[model samples]
Target: MRVHKFTFAALAVAAGLTLTACQSGEDGAAQGGASSAPPGSPAASAPASPGGGSSSGGTDQSGGKNSAGTGSDGKGTAAGAGSDGTGKAGKCRTGDLEITAIDSTVGGDSDGTVAVQLKNRGGQDCTLSEYAGVDLKTSAGSLSAKRTGEHPGPVVLKKGKAVSFGVTYPLNTSGGSGVRVTGLVVTPPDETKSVTLAWPGAATLPVTEGTGSPVKVGPIGSAGQGG
Candidate 1:
């Protein structure tokens, strides 16, 4: 009886140890699974990247294409970069002009006869007539009310245009009037859209250089014969 009891006690002890080992193994597995979970998972700790959309000063963070923006260097960049900085671009068109004069001396005027040329350069027909008034200036001050002759009727110059006319008056030669042409302007008819005429610094009348003969003062331009 003693031997049987000893055997039974040994078996019971063995079974208990086996059960403990199995329980310990199960607990270890559960702990391992909890510790090794991916980040942000139910069993994890660290937070994920700053993703899903943080924002800036009203700028979207989704990296989408913007309507009024394209990630440029923040400058004045648009359609009309060189046209007028107005973000608009178009062709520069205008009517034509021609000027001429008669002088006795090269670079000098004895009889004081000056002529003008007119034409339509704006590819289309335009109405034009010599203005009947002029504005003169001198070092002393400005002088208005200069007497001018009656100009011809409004002439329509179609496309490639040219004309020559004359100005015969003994204009006073003194002060700034000697060399500087204070003003020479042209006005387009109200029907056409045109900018204010800015005549080049050319002499409205012919100017002579070395001799007493007269030379064309200005109207420096390019010929637009071919489009």
Candidate 2:
């Protein structure tokens, strides 16, 4: 009986040790499973970053806005750039031209005509249009010519080429005193300065009193041609 009791006790102790070892093995397996999960898994200890995805998306949208704003600024700068007037050789100035007057004749009740010639003395080509401003100066006063209704096209004056315009007036009228003109003052189209040329001794433009606008000026045209 004593030996049987001792064997029974030894068997009980071994069973207890086996049970403890099995429980410890189960706990170790649970801990290892928890540690082995990937960092991006749903059950991870770190909280989910909800803003991270939205922040990346917002950065892309902001990049588009920045590019659009830069494009608008570039277009605004381009729109503000004006034409530099290089096309069409620019308008002619008074200093780039030479002015002179030549005697001319008109038929049928018209007294006489004076062809005012304009020569391009500059190195570059220029444009001339419209009627030149003419003033007849005498010892009494000054008389301006009336601008005619003729509309001529723009005349491009190259170097050493000439253009002409005419002034027609009545020399003497019936039962009126004749007025004498001593000098002629000519101004180029769209110009402020003027040049004076002496009147020809043989060709005298006599303006009669009581005649409204005795002088009429024509538009600029080719040299020796009526506008």
- Residue-level lDDT of model 1, residues 1-227, one tens digit each, is 99999999999999999999999889989787556567776435543336743233355569875566543676543553334345432222333433322232325654344334445455444444433222233232333332233434444444466544333333344333354454443322232333322223334332224433232221211111211
lDDT tens per residue, model 2, 1-227: 99999999999999999999999889989887565667876556554357643232333454354333445446522222122254465567789888889877645645677888888888777777787898888655788999888777777777778888888777664444556678999999888999999864223445555746778888888336321
Candidate number of the best TM-score: 2
Query: What global local distance difference test value does model 2 have?
Result: 0.73
Give the Cα error of residue 156 in candidate 1, in Å. Answer: 2.0
> What ranges in model 1 sit over 4 Å off?
1-111, 130-133, 144-152, 171-227
Against the true structure, what is each candidate's TM-score? 0.30, 0.56
The count of residue-pair clashes in candidate 1 stands at: 19
